[model samples]
Structure formats: C-alpha cells, structure tokens
Target: MKIGLYFGTFNPIHVGHLIIANHMAENSDLEQIWMVVTPHNPLKKKNTLLDDYHRLQMVFLATESFPKIKPSDIEFKLPQPNYTVNTLAHLQEKFPQHEFALIMGEDNLNSLQKWKNYEVILQNHDIYVYPRLNSGEIDSQFINHSKIHRVGAPVIELSSTFIRESIKNNKNVVPMLPNKVWEYIDHNLFYKK
Candidate 1:
C-alpha cells in the first residue's frame, strides 16, 4: 500500500486541509492519506499550540467519516521537535510493505533545503506538492533529480490560524470547519478569547 503523509499541527482541523487530502486520495495512486499530526513541528512556534492529544482528537473527529483520510499520532510517540526525515525512516521500518510519499505545499517546497537531511528525504521518498496562492513560482531545478510530483487541487486562501483567530474573536466559523469539528471546538471552547 502507498501512503501520502500530510503532516501538520492541525491546531484545529479545517476545510482546506480536508480538501487537499481528499483531492490527493481521489487523484493519486496513494491508497490513503494519513494526517500525521505533529506534536511539535521543528520549524514552527510552540507557544500557541494546543495539547497534542486534544488536537489529535479533533483531527480524529474531523476525518472520521472519510475512510481514506486518517488521523495519525505517530509523531506523538517519537522524540520531541520531530524531523521529517526521521519520521519517514521510522515509518518505513515499521511498515516495510508500504510505500510513503510526502504531501506538502509549494511554500514548503521553496524552503526544502533548510530541513534536516532534506536531501536524504528527497532522494528516498516521493513528494506531492500543492501550490499555495501567490507563493512564488516553484523551482523545478531544485528537485530535478528527486521524485517530486505536482497536484491539481483547488487552492484556498483559508488556514487554521485564520479560523482560530476568528473563533477567538467570536466570529462565525461555520464555513471554515466541518460540522463535527465546529461542534467539538464550541463544546471545548477552544481558542476562546
């Protein structure tokens, strides 16, 4: 089985995240897309992040209806400040029969060089990139020798952070999240001001 690992903090799972995962599952050779919820991303801030378990539960709730989309806590048990290369290596060892691909946006594609052992990751795994709006043109030359592919998913300007802030400010967020996710957020008073 081939899997596309869509890694993110998913402080609160939202629609844009679901759309891309759905598009990937429907269009690609991938058997499923595991929303690998990172407890602590090495590249992002940690102060504002919610509890890893809580975030993971929200992801589970958001993706429960979709058979092809799964919420994973693989990184939660891994060492702190998780790195992509390490996570991929671990998953490969644990599931030797399955092939894994990296699912990310073109924005991250531009900064691939900064990731730890990025070359090893690029050389070992296939990458599926979805272009972000106005995130400058992708340089094909960088991954010329790597197995990188582009997806044709619709680009949305929405992000989890925007939805979080909206909820914090007491704004209507029905359109930004799934019904189950919105209910969970409301019940827990997540991101309350």
Candidate 2:
C-alpha cells in the first residue's frame, strides 16, 4: 500500500483541508492519506498552537466520514520539535509494508532545503505538492525533480491562522471550519483570548 502523509497542526479542520485530501486521494497514486497530527512543528511557533490532543480531535471529527483520510497521532509520542525526517523514519519503521510519500503545499517547497536532511527525503520519498496562493503562475521550468509531482487541486485561501484569529476576536468561524469542529471550538472556548 502507498500512503501520502499530509502533516499539519489542524488547529481546526476546515473544508479546504478535506477538499485537498479528497482531491489527492482521487488523483494520486496514493491509496490513502494519513493526516499526521503534528504535536509541534519545528518551523512553527509553539505558543500559537493549541493542545495536541485538541487539534487531533478536530482532525478526527472532521475526517470521520472520509474513508480515504485518517487521523494519525504518531507525533504525540515522538520527541518535541517534530521534524518531517524523524516522523517519516518512525512511520517507515512502524509500517514497513506501506510505501510512504510526503504531501505538502508548494508554498513550503522553496523552504524545503532548510528542513533537516531534506536531501535524504528527496532521494527516498516521493513528494506531492499542491498549488498555493500566487505560486501557480510560476513556470514549470522552476520545478525540476523526479521525486516531486504537482497536484491539480483547488487552491483554497482559507488558513488555520485566520480561523484562530476569528475565534480570539469573537468573530463567527462557523464557515471556516466543519460543523463538528465549530461546535467543539465554541463549546471548549479554543483560541479565546
């Protein structure tokens, strides 16, 4: 089995996320996409993140009906400042039978070289990059890699940062997230200032 590991904090799962996962699952060689619930991303600030378990729960609730997508808590038990290289290594060890690939947005592609042992990742694992806002116009000449593949997915402008700020300001975030996630956020007061 071939799996695409879509890593993210998923502070609150939104429609845009589901759309991407669905699009990839339908179009890619991947059999399934594991929503790797990142406990703490090395590149992101820790203070801005919600509790890992809370974020994981939101992913679980939002992707419940989607068979091709699953919530993975693999990073919760791993070391702090989670790095993609470490997570991929651990997952490969745990699920040796399944071939794993990295799934990310093109916005992160430019910074890929900064990631720990990024060269090793490019050599060993396949990468599926979705188009990001304003990056679609980039010429195909810029993308030159046998390991990298571009996905034809809808470019969604929605972001978790926007949703978090809305909650902090007491703005309605119902449209930003799924119904279950919105209810959970409202009930638990997540991101409240």
Given candidate 2, what's the lDDT at residue 1? 93
Model 2: per-residue Cα lDDT over 16-107, one tens digit each: 89899989999999999999887865567677688888899999999998899999999899987778899889989999999999888988
- Write the residue-wise lDDT of candidate 1 on 1-193 in tens digits: 9999999989888999999999999999888999999886656766668888889998999999999999999999898778899999999999999999999998999888889998899889999988798877666666565488888888977888888889889999998898998998899888886
- Those runs of model 2 whose alpha carbons end farther than 4 Å from true positions after fitting are 41-46, 136-142
For model 1, state the Cα shift of residue 27 in Å: 0.4
TM-score of 1: 0.94
Find the candidate with the highest TM-score and give its number: 1
lDDT score, residue 120, model 1? 92
Which is the leading candidate under lDDT?
Answer: 1
lDDT of 1 at 100: 96
lDDT of 1: 0.89
Judged by whole-model lDDT over C-alpha atoms, candidate 2 comes out at: 0.87
